[model samples]
Target: MTMLRDQGIILINKDSEISSAAVVAQVRRLLGMKRVGHCGTLDPFATGVLPVVFGRATAAVPYMSEYDKEYRCRIQLGSSTDTMDREGEIIKQAPENFDASKLEDPSYVEQLLNSFLGEIKQQAPLYSAVKVAGKPLYKYARQGKEVERPWRTVTVHSIKLLGIYHREGFELPCLDVLFSTSKGTYIRSLADSIGSKIGCYAHAAELERTACGPFTLDQTVKTADLFDCFEGLGRDSKAFLSASIDEGIVKATLTAFAGFPTQAVELSDAIKLTHGQEIKVFPDDITLDTVTFTYNNVLLAVAGVNRGLAKVKRVFTDSSAEFLREGSIDEDI
Candidate 1:
């Protein structure tokens, strides 16, 4: 028989130089599991809080991806890149009429930042991964093929200009910014637009994600540190990787995904949940769009509550028709 898989979310302080897919592959090798999935995609030039879900926790991917994210970015004025970031080719320059002192005034900079707040519409970068006609935009851009990218509406939520700094070799002025934004917002695009709004051209020089919903950089482990732990594992290695792994990454039991608030469900209801049955929900729990059903210290289901009942959206635990029969089930379920 196949053994039960150890599953939970692992937050990695992603290395900016590495692609997100590489991080997932590395984790899969370290734990020897095939079901791992990353909660968000970070560009190779960006790094910080990347949540990797394993086994049963994979059910939480869609729900967790919706959380607002916070990023710390460096915006270099007077220059713009085709990719909207340092990695891309420079394609635009600030108008010569640019006054270096305009950004020196804090109030002017605040106004420029405020313009990004609330709903804003933008065209996705040509080098972006956004798909058009079922093909990634970047793939077309690489071949010198032009595809009309659609304008997407996204919210900045909030923005704060940290400070302006000087880069010795580069001619442009750079601004450090921290902002929380909706899932689809691209910081590089936002940075470039802010520069244009202020009559200066800019591209994202550096980016590091600091937070995503309740998860923060504080809980992440450096990518190198995580892999170094399993450098010598072999037949002689300790059997339990959970006890050996950092942050209980491969632990069977974990805190229910905080992205969706939870509600307690009785034993019978949980058993029925596995079969996708709708169970009665209390009035107070009705307000929750997604409810986690917890019972006996285990997360049994992530449900959608409506019309005074909860319907299973994602079931983590297994249930059998035999168990649903009265007196046929045991407490172990």
Candidate 2:
């Protein structure tokens, strides 16, 4: 099996009905080397763009989490579910012949959506993975144990109605919406709250993540294609390719940490550094020593200390291979 040499980001176009963890596992096998991690999580019932970080790019996870997310969602009206989604048990139902006009009134929908914008306190649904006393809240709910969950504040940047449609003489109404929100905003809770505002019950029917930070569905690769690429590469070629990729990651880390200009290096030219000097390298930040420019985070190499000297370190070919071989494979997926 060949390991990836460069730290790069993989944009996966995930489909519904499978857990996010399952997708990560499949990618791990395809790549054949560990140290893979994802930026954000999507529920098993939801699907869309999922960005994966490999090798030193894994260090970018925290920074990625802060990125804005966008979702295309559908909400079914006049019926409420225990979990605040269509998959949950129906807990309440409104009277038949519910006037769809109530939902369309600008004052009504605008008021409801406005309440959710900015900072607001919300209670996470019971059927969630939030931990309580070292156990998941959903785990307790399945056992019929009721627990009080405190409301937490979340930010919603914007919410727009993409479209609205209703079936003639149908009991329920549904709305298609687009959401641009900060991290941790629950679409299900938003649905539940909106339903309550209009004297009807509602739950999420469908959700598809369109974007997360800079990653979008258009840039995502299919799992099958990634697998095919993995199978076609020869072992030696794979090793060499993976090593080269790792070196590129080290260089990027150095550039990021040093706050050097992105164009500082010429094509195929390397950054020079000195041995045994503590130099900071940034993989995702201007400050902080998240990653060091050295061999195994030690043993700095001397490239030169002139004004033109970009911190260059001695390349360790064998160590890069060993690092990939011994790197941790136990990822969340």
TM-scores for every predicted model: 0.88, 0.70
* lDDT of residue 45 for candidate 1: 92
> Cα RMSD (Å) per model?
4.3, 8.9
lDDT of 2 by residue, 1-333 (tens): 123345556777888888777888876776665877887888788889887776666665665677778998888888889889878998988766667676766566666767777887889789887788888788988999999875788888888876677755546668888888888778888888888777788888888889987667786767776555555665343553354355332123232223212222211121233222333333332432122333333222223233333344333223334533464332221
Worst 10 residues of 1 by lDDT: 321-330
* Residue 176 displacement (Å), model 1: 0.5
Q: What is the C-alpha lDDT of each candidate?
A: 0.77, 0.64
The clash count for each model shown is: 0, 19
lDDT of 1 at 149: 89
How do the residues 167-271 of candidate 1 rate in per-residue lDDT, one tens digit apiece? 887766789999999888889899888878877789998999999777889878876775666664442223435444543444332343665576766667777
